[model samples]
Target: MRPTGPLATIRNRAAAVAYPVFYRLPRGLRRWLVRRVAPTYTVGAVVLLYDIDQAGDRTGQLLLLRQPGNRGWSLPAGLLDRGERPIDGAARELAEETGVELTTGQLTPATPNAVIHHHGRWVDVVFEAQAPATETTLRVDGAEVHDAAWHPLADLPPLSRATARLLAHYGISSPHTPLDPQPTSGQPDQPGPA
Candidate 1:
């Protein structure tokens, strides 16, 4: 039998608050429900940063891509090459998407946890960085990315929810308005793959 003490009660409460409502079901059912909520997923690594020189007092720009697959704006991100380290993958993605080499000293893990998706299959390990705001040029891969640009923190085009959450962690807010006390939880207008 399970322990029935104050500790157990607190544990139960914490579990309820941290997980979905259906977590109380049988193990198999609970797992099935959770999987059903976020079925398709793949892993990727990402980089974030601000260029201090060219990007003055404004919050640093996030590197973004207009990809053919999603045909929408997203963080400068890509899937990890098999057997690659997360940080290495992040740096590789940064270079591939923007032509900016993220030296070992410049990369940091923003989120090690998997970025889940109920709609698509993409799990990304995000990295954060801050660099001098210089006029860095971009050379994008047309097959994967049609366009690349530095988006001011305030005026991001519709992007992924996971990408937005990562930005919020750095104290940035919506580009369309002044900073709100709470970050937005709603979806942006970009359409996902059909």
Candidate 2:
């Protein structure tokens, strides 16, 4: 039987009241509860905008943003809205975070969907596009992104794990290497006093 009139109104009101409370819980708990209640999964997209320098040995520079909340440097990314296509979501997130508008046709798939498991399982669709090296002006949304800059494929700051993995998948190595673990002196390693 269809819920009509007061019954429907009561159900709607109950959901409205419950949703905020549910959202306030820690992300892990919220996802756990949601999974128990329904089949819940999230889809996201990350956009890697590259500028190919035809004159500079045909090198490419990739755009990255320093996101707020210590998320580290990442490509512009966000969760897709319901009923939205992955390409469309990529375009939307790119425009929203970087103020760079792109048509859906311009983006090419960078990798197969990357499944990330954390508090919630996420399937991230990655996309990349080539932009003019000199023409594009990048403006970051201050609330989410603190800064935006383009780095050559060989030089990059500390990257978020997902971003690092993406670059590794593409076989691109960043110039920012970790300090060597070996001591400069050729001495036997000694353990600290317990």
Q: Compared with the true structure, what per-residue lDDT tens digits does model 1 show for residues 89-122?
A: 8888878877787685778766544444433445
Q: Write the per-residue lDDT of candidate 2 for residues 1-194, one digit (tens) a residue.
A: 87889989999999999999989999999988877988555788888788866553335688888886544477888888989998999999989988899999988988654534333345667888877657788888688888888888777877765565555546665555332232344211221100
Q: At residue 138, what lDDT does model 1 achieve?
A: 79
Candidate 2 weakest ten by summed lDDT: 185-194
Candidate 1 error regions (>4 Å): 1-41, 54-59, 111-122, 160-162, 165-194
RMSD of each: 8.4, 14.6
TM-score of 1: 0.59
Query: What CA RMSD would candidate 2 show?
Result: 14.6
Question: What lDDT does candidate 2 reach at residue 110?
Answer: 82
Candidates' TM-scores? 0.59, 0.65
State residue 192's C-alpha deviation in candidate 1, in Å: 7.1
